[model samples]
Structure formats: structure tokens, C-alpha cells
Target chain A: MGNIFRFIARYHLFLLFAVFQSVALVLTFSNRSYHRSWFWNTTQEGTATILEAYTAAEEYVHLRKTNRALAEENARLRGLVEDSKYIGTVKRGGRKDTLQQYTYTAAHVINISFHKRNNYITIDRGFLHGIKPGQGVICPTGVVGVVNQVSRHYSSVIPLLHSRTRLSGSMSKTKHFGSVIWQGGNHRRAQMLDVPRQANIQLGDWVVSDTRSAMFPSGLRIGKVAAFSLDPESQSYVVDVRLSVDFASLQMVYVIDNLLKKEQVRLEESSAQEPE
Target chain B: MRHPLSALLWSIVALFFQVFVLGNVQLFGYLNPYLYPIIFILWPLSWNRATGLIVAFLMGFTIDFFEHSGGLQASAATLLFMIRPWIVRAVAPRSEMESMPLTLQAMGQPKFLTYTGMSLLIFHLWLFWWEAFDFFELFSILFRSILSAGVATVLVYTIQLFSLKSE
Candidate 1:
């Protein structure tokens, strides 16, 4: 009716604002719930191209630091070469065998954000380059993040500093397992929860990735325990860890492809289906 | 004064500056100066309110696309546009009412700064609050809003100064 038209004309601005805000809210809440819109993220070809161009322009400013980090990483990798080691563990007379369960794909970081609560990192490698969602990523020094979404030429990573990131970590010395989670203020720190009170723990003790998770290789360095205290309610220690990777200056990383991931998942599902 | 083409141009320039340049600057790990709000602040007063809202929404969505942040920017920008008219009316002198353009040179420095500064503060508070939503660090949020507003105010004013034609 004309009355409805008059009402709409009178409050059209407000209506438009409400509609826009609602749409925005939908995008935000859905993204928070991990149902990210495919077209909005940096994976979009145009956005990725712009970011890559900006990174290229800024590359020189970080060249020295990048070179130094790469050099240190190279030195570490050099020590792992076959020529540097003798047969420390002599194999008894048995069938000679070797198993390869992981592959590393080198990728350049195109864009990254560490200041936000729900930060994401965009890398140059994508599906075409064998990057896939849920694959773990690591830098030369330590674990970085896990791939969240992939496009043809780029992928976004959910960095460890993000609030939603829950990485399984363990005390290197005692092998006590805990869940490492970022509490959303500091980029350099995360908290490890559910560590039993009886476990022998110490300040500066290394916290490495737990082998129980197939996403990451066992024993990759995550961080070191900075502080710890007994939780009155859970009767467990809440330990604070200083993350090893400096997300601010991270430039290069490797996407880890767990070759046996599918097999492990299938086997676990099959066993679960059996009656308890 | 309400040239749609010019508005479009300004929107593109501001979006480019915000995503490509200012996005990189994060002082003390939290304070990120945002200059895109200047688009709404200086928008011609005679422009259609509905058009302005639509423009604000699209501009915000574009920024969100580049930042990889979902709808935080879009919502905040919409809210900013909604309140912009009131801020301008409040800070502008009665004598300046006839001037449709809300420019720094037209309103003078004090009123211009107050108008833009208020809008930037509200915009940033809305943005950082939702961004650090789960953290519940209100002190940090307030600090970020005030500090970033100050920096964004300076940057916006500087851009205006450069564009102003000397008499």
C-alpha cells in the first residue's frame, strides 16, 4: 500500500544501515565460527596479487634479516646432512628399510597479521603448489601455523597466535602433554592447559609438539615454559610459554604434508566404529 | 560539491592507502592509524543519506576483503556513516551551515578536528572491540581507540592540507 511506501521512504536510511550492519555481522560471526566466505579472504586472486606486490616492494627492507635467518637455518640443515653423522645406532642384521612419512614444501609469506585476536597469515603457495587445509606449517626455527583455506595460487594460515588455534604440546623433559592456546593479548606468549600437577616441570623447559597429533612432526619446538602455577579448580598447572617463532618478522616457512595422514585417519575411524 | 565521480575517486584512493600502506603500520603492536574514515567525514552534506550508507558499506567490505578480516570493518564503517551527520551538525558553526562540503578548510581546524576525531574514535572502538572480542581486554581496547584516533586524525588532517588549494 501507499502507507508502507511512505514508511519506507521516511526511514530508508535507517533501514539501509540496519541491513548493511546485519550483512556485516553475518560475515563476521560466520567467519568467527570458521565458515569463512571464500571470496572475502586474501586468497581472492586480486587481493593476493596486491599483497604480493606490496610484499615485493617491502622485501628489501627485510632482506638483511631474512638473509640472517636463512643463514642460521641453512647451518642447522647442514648439520643434518648424511656426511655430518656417523652410524650412531648400528642396525643389527635385518632387512634394510626406510620410511618417508612427511614432505616439506617451501613457501614465501606474502602477508601476515599478528596484532589481531583472530590473525591469519597468507602464503604464496596454494592448492596448485600442493598446499591444503589442515596441513601444518613451520619456519626455519619453529612451528608457525596450519593451513586454513587454499586458493589456486595462495592460501591462508591460522597462525599459532590466533585465539582459535589449539596446538597439542608437551613438556620436552617430562613428556607431560598439554594443550597450547593463545589467550589473545601478547603475540609472543601462549598458555598450556591441563598439565598435571605431579609432572616434573621447570622454568625454561622446552615445550614441543606432541606426537599424538598427526598434523605436526613429533618434537618440533613450539616454545619454552615461562611461568607456571597450580590451578585451584582443575588441580592442574597452567603454564605460560614464550612462543619460539617471532611472527612479526617471519618471511619463509615450509608446509608439512603428512603422507600417512589419510591412512591414520581411516584406521582411527575404522577402530572407533568397532563396539567398545 | 556533491560530485559522485569525485566521491568515487576519493573512495578508491582512501581504500588503496588504507589497505596497502597504513595496514603495515602498527605502533606498539596495537595502535593502527586508520585514514579511510575521512571519506565519510568529508562527504558532501547534500549527498543522499542512502547513497552514503551504501558507499560506506561497500568501502568497508573492500577493506575487510584485503585485511582478511570478515565484517568488522564493514559494520564499523556503516555505524560511522550513520553517526556522521550528527557529528558534523554538532561541531559546525551556524554560519558554516550553508557550505555543503565538510572540509577542513571550510570548517576551520578546531571544528574539523573535533568532528573527524570523534568519528575516528568511535570507528576504531567498534573495530578493535569486535577484533579483540574474545579477549575482553577493555583497557587495551580503550587505549587503542584513543591512540589510533589521534594518529588517524593527524594523518587525515595532513592529507586535507596537501589537497587544499592556497588562495
Candidate 2:
């Protein structure tokens, strides 16, 4: 008994170190999903105090621009809902056209970074504010980006200015569809590849987001096509597009929360239940 | 009169500042200045090893909780504190190397300051390199460590000067 007791005392320090290292390993490895971490609560509390000190300072400096942007957004949204009522074509003597429907929640940009190769923007709204991953963000003029990461008090968005930002967009008048990608050279310009030459297109032709997106509603204004050419390297046509949102001047945005997202996802998920 | 209690108190203050205040002020993206572990560096030569290790563990664990890096800092800090006695002995002045205070009063300003600064650089190198687990991109890792160390070294020196002045 005495011998065993002495051995335990001698090895206690090594055992303690092992315990601590294993705890660390669990923290690093076990929690790959961002949702699992308590980082949100802690970061929110800390940033709240920090941002409070900056809010008063921002009021006098950022007031005029923010107000004008909000007024412009309000005017544009009213026009979209009131004027452009999409008509449904009847097939087999029946027609189904959902009304112009979209819900918008105002969010303030808290922290943003475009310097990184994989850029992300964090806003001052989160799960509590009806913000979720895959929701589209927009400024007064056009589409901003999509929410990629979300927490209780903050959500990180991948901006349209990123080198890898991609969206499903199409030309307005012509039935031309292409994939939008940022060249990283300029914040305002994104290039669309995979366009077919069969469709009619022009330089100043308007382009907007499509219904193909799982989250963003159809016809959200993207930008205007800037330049186009049949690439010599590849047969597919490529067009330079000028995005609407000025990321440098971005202050406020609206997080669009689709009411039908949950029901749509559940229906798709259940259909995959059958064995392969 | 002995000053062990004062040293312990200052170390707690340093740890609090590092974990709470400095964690929020991220300079760019990856760089986080960890000045708390320097409390072990500035301890008097005669300060106990057990105290240094305990203080280092607490400091590292506090940082771990905030950064979600469980034991990486703790392990590096313990390793640094363990080797601190030998580094101090090697760099100390030949004449006043065995003195109790081991400060400028005992070993002149130049010799004592050189010893303190060099040992600190070595500690920073060990902590940052090990914390990163010797990745291939070692240049940027070392650069960040040096920049953070320079700022932290100034903070430590200021604290020491103020403490000495008060005394």
C-alpha cells in the first residue's frame, strides 16, 4: 500500500500534463463545426462593450451617408413590390404565380475584411435577429453577398468583391445565363463565364440574380454587363459585369430571410430516404 | 525585507492585462501580442521555480480559454519557465551573477539589461515556434513573434521602472 502511494505521488505531475494536453486536443479536433463553439457568446459580450465606445464616435461621422442610403433602399423596395407584378401564364387552364414576396431585416455592418484571399464580413445581427446562413445581403443599389457563417449575435458574409465569390446571374432582356466571378482586380467589377453565344447580349444590358438560388429570391438586381467576348482559349463567352454595391462605401444592408426555406429543405431531405 | 509577495502580485496584474485587454486588440488578423508570460521572465533570480511554473500555467490557461487553444500556450510557457534559470545564469555578469536582487543596482545597468533582454528573446522564440509546431512558414511566424515581443518588452520595462520608482 505504501509503495503504491509513493508511485502515485511521483507520477502525478506527468499525469496532470497529459490531462491538460488531451483537453486541448479535444478542443482543437472535436469541434470542427462553427456552431458547436461557445465563442459566439463570449465574442458578442466583449464586442458589445467595445462597439459601444465606437458607436457615439461613428454617429457624427457616418450619419448623413447612412440616412441617404436607407431612404434610397426604401424607395427601391416600394417600387419593386408595387410596380413589377409578375403574371402567370396558364397551362391546362390553370395558373400558379406566387405574389411578389420577400422579407427584409435591417443589419449593421460590424466588422468587415476584404484583404484576405477568402474574405468574410461580420454584421451586428444573427440567429436572434432572423439571420441565417445562405441568406442574401443587399445594399441600396443591388446584391451584396451571402451569409456563410452565423452566430447568436453575429453573422459572417462572403462579399461579392471576393476573388472566389460566385453567383447565378442572367441578362435581363435576353435569356442568357452565366456564372459571376470576381477577378480581384477591382471591387466594382465581376466577370461572368459560361455564357453561350446563341443568346443576344449587349454591353449596357442589365443583369440580376436568378431563381436558381436556394436562398435569394429571383430578380434581385445584380449589375450591368460591362464587356463581353468569345474567349479564344475556350469557346464559351465571357462578359465583364459591374456590380451595384460599392463595398468600400458599404455601411448598412438587409438580410433576406426566406419564409419557405425550412419547408423546401425538409421536402428535399425526405425524398432521399430510399436506399440507393 | 523580502519582495516575493510584490512579484506575485505584479504577475497576476500582467496575466489579467494579457488575457482581457490585449486579446481584443488584434493588430492585423493573425497577430496576437501575448505579454503575460513575460512575468516569469522578469522575476528575480532567486524566485522559486514552482511559483514560475504555477503562474505560467494559470497565464497560459487563461489565454487558452479566450482563444480556444486549449493547452498549446500552457505547454510552451511551462517549457520556457523550466529553462529560465539556466538562461539567467548563463547571461548574468561574472562579478554579481550570484547576487540576491540580480538587478542594475547589483550588476551594473548594461550587463543586467543585456542578460534580461537576450533571455526574453530566447523565451519568445521558443514559445512562438513551439506554439506553431514548427510549420514551414517559419519566417512570418518569427516576424510576428519579434514584433509582439518588442511591444511587450517595452511594456515590461515600463512596469519594472514604475515599480522600482514607487519602491
Please tell me which predicted candidate would have the highest lDDT against the true structure. Answer: 1
Q: Model 1, range A97-148, lDDT digits (tens) per residue?
A: 8788989999999998877667889999988999989999999889998998
Name the candidate that leads on DockQ: 1
Q: Which residue pairs overlap in candidate 1's backbone?
A: none
Distance from true position, residue A263, model 1, in Å?
3.1
Docking class of 1: medium
TM-score of 1: 0.89
Least lDDT summed over 10 consecutive residues: which range in candidate 1 chain A? Answer: A34-43
Across B1-167, the per-residue lDDT of candidate 1 in tens digits comes to: 25889889989999998887788765666667789988888888777888888899999998887777778899999999999878877887666665557888877889888998999999999988888774567888888789899999998898888879553
A120-198 per-residue lDDT for model 2 (tens digits): 5667887888887789898777888998667677777788765446888888887678888774435677888888877
lDDT of each: 0.85, 0.66
